[model samples]
Target: MAHLRDDSRGQLLLVAGLALALVFIGLALVVNSAIFTENLASRGETAGSSGALAARAATEANAGTAIEQANHYNPSAPVDAFNRSLRNVSTQTEALSATSGTLSNVTYAGHRNGKRVSGAIDRTNNSYTVADSVERVSGANGTRGLVFNASDLPGESTPLVVKVNDTTATGDRNSWRAQIWETTSDVHVKTFRNGTSASENRTERCSVPSSTANRIEVTAGLVNGQPCDALRRNDSGANFWFGNGAGDEYDVHFKNTNYTTGDFEMVVYSGGGPSILLTTLSDDAIYDAEVQFVYDGPDVWYNTSVRVAPGEPDA
Candidate 1:
């Protein structure tokens, strides 16, 4: 009877040990699976964040392009034309995001109205105003979309000078000026801004070969179709696209326009201005736009509002 009891006890001990071993193995598997799942979720979320940001950038860029194109197409009915163009842009961007396994959408929220002034750069002996009493878009900080196309520009002595004068500026020291001239081989863009005093004055110059391109996109900060350092940023690290230091409200004027033969254009953010030498007719245009952007992906969701203003100062 004692031997039988001992044998039974040994068998029970073996069974208990086997059950504990199996339990430990099962628990280990469950813990490892949990850790792996958590890691996967973290990685997925990181990727999703990147995708969302990329989508946002694409949407904004496309919207800006669409706005410019729309203005060119239907300047008479600016807002309606921009809406139609924006819809097409949104649809294309959405499809593009899907290819990367992300979902995205862009919708136009609204726009600001402005005037598009364009005409010849051919004035006679004296400087003249292209647009007077021009102001930035209501509530906006600056102007945008100033461009010039010219050839056979004269020398610095009687150059084609463009000025943005602060309506309230007391003297030339407060106005911003751009002097366009040509060397034998290159076209030059020189910028001047005498902030408040002579010591605060700043000037910069950039040049491109005359044979390259005839376009100088002032607000866009390009010369001969290439980026120009002088028009982009001033010595103080402030953007001087059209002219810094001049108040947001200013007058656009041309000096020695005969020195350069070309066409010029700009979008004055103000409601409307009296027709001047350069502009015979001012077209209604969309100056800027607002849009909503949305993105969704594995473990991530993003939504934001973006303002699209092409060639905007410091944009």
Candidate 2:
């Protein structure tokens, strides 16, 4: 009876010890799991912050590229290139983050002279769109603004407008006007015919009176019946002839014009002592003008500004 009692007591002790060992193992596993979960959460937050910074950097780089392209002879191509570059940067940054299981959102925002320019992107679904809300502040030349939300991830869209401004104009005329000539060869020259003979003549080449060099041709001859011929003339000679008569007045008109090359300029002042011309990419018409992007930020909480300096030609 004593031996049986002793054996039963030993069995109970062994069972209790086994239970305690199992319990300890379970507790250790739980603690290790908690630590792993905490580490993962911290990594995710770090990724989000890094992603935002990368996206913002890409956005600003794109804006700067677009602005520099605006100074190019063929702006459309460069502008297109600029957009592609931005997208590429976005993709790369997203890929970098996506390796860690995070998605990316890239966008564009544009502004000029410190004013908010309207911008948007339409997704393939056609039911949704992302829009940029821009704001401006005072700058060296004038008011300048930063662009935001210029692009959307998971969708491709074009800029609503390209930002351009004239820094100079040269002419006796104080008022500056922008013109869009359809063809590269549309520049017009006026030939004066002798009153009595067809042989006597002086050829005057007339171009759109703006600081920029591209000539713009339109169907209409004048604005509000006010003749541009009177206001526009080459400083060296009288290039434009004004009058309803066929020979007395020559109207420069462009037919079947191709603005695809994107060679154009922004005339800063209309009638003034000297005109400053801001060069831009090629565009079809003055109506196709757009604002360029300069800056972008995240958190929707910080105030930012952009500075535009005249780009000079390479020596």
Candidate 3:
């Protein structure tokens, strides 16, 4: 009986040894699995971080390209290209779960060395952000001649301020001459020949030479209730005569009763003769002539005449 008991005990010890080995194998498998899982998690985190960084970089790059293109090339082309690139980047980033993570706050910012540039940003769900700015740049050659056309004249008696830039050497503002033509009979022309000729008789009388034709002639300068030597000579051309050899200063003023129908035309001249011909007439004959720039040691001067006319005025 004792021998049988010892055999059973040996069999029990072998079974216990087998059970211990199986437990150790199971523990080893568990530890290896934990290590593998940790490695996978670390790799996923790194991939996600990289994707996010890539998306950010793409956004910045697209913004920069768009701004640069707008400065040099056509503004629309670069803007469109930038918008497309941004959309592409946004789409790609949103699709990548590893990049954006659980946050949905994805945005693209545009700047030039910390200075915010003008552009348009399109977000999700058709939402967008836009920024714009305007800058004026001057020309290198400066201003040319006085830019005057038939669009800048005054229509009423509103007080106007005329600005003149002296680009020429001529200091004499009165050197510039203007030829004015009256269209109505009520409007009269007056000329002042120095202070010695009296002030009241500065107006020149207008008369109809022939009844058949509507030709009007201004003959003889009114001086102190008498006719002066300055006469409207019909010898050479149709022009107001200021004496044969008169070197005196003259100031001409036109007065009209009706401001609406009263019309006149004028052209600027440099020396004795007129420069440009008076082809057009203004309804309200009121103009101010000022000297502007002069070129080549004041030999040629640029002048601007602002006429307040009835209709649309010229600049």
Q: Model 3, range 1-315, lDDT digits (tens) per residue?
A: 345578788998999999999999999999999999989877776655554444445444443443334322443243344445546644554455334232211333331111112211111212111111111111111101111111122222421111111222122232111122233332222332222223411323332211211111222232222332223422343233432112222222222212222112221112222112111211111111111111111111112221111111111
**What is the C-alpha lDDT profile of model 1 across 187-238, one tens digit per residue?**
8888887777798777888898775347888888887778886788755775
lDDT, candidate 2, 79-166, per-residue tens? 4554555466556655764665555544333322211112222222222211111111121211111111211111012211121112
C-alpha-based local distance difference test score of model 3? 0.28
- In model 2, the number of clashes is 42
Ranked by TM-score, top first: 1, 2, 3
- Supply the global lDDT for candidate 2: 0.31
Which should have the higher lDDT, number 1 or number 3?
1
Q: Each prediction's TM-score against the native?
A: 0.79, 0.25, 0.22
Q: What are the lDDT figures for the candidates, one per model?
A: 0.77, 0.31, 0.28
**Each prediction's Cα RMSD?**
7.1, 24.3, 34.2
**How many clashing residue pairs appear in each of the predictions shown?**
0, 42, 17
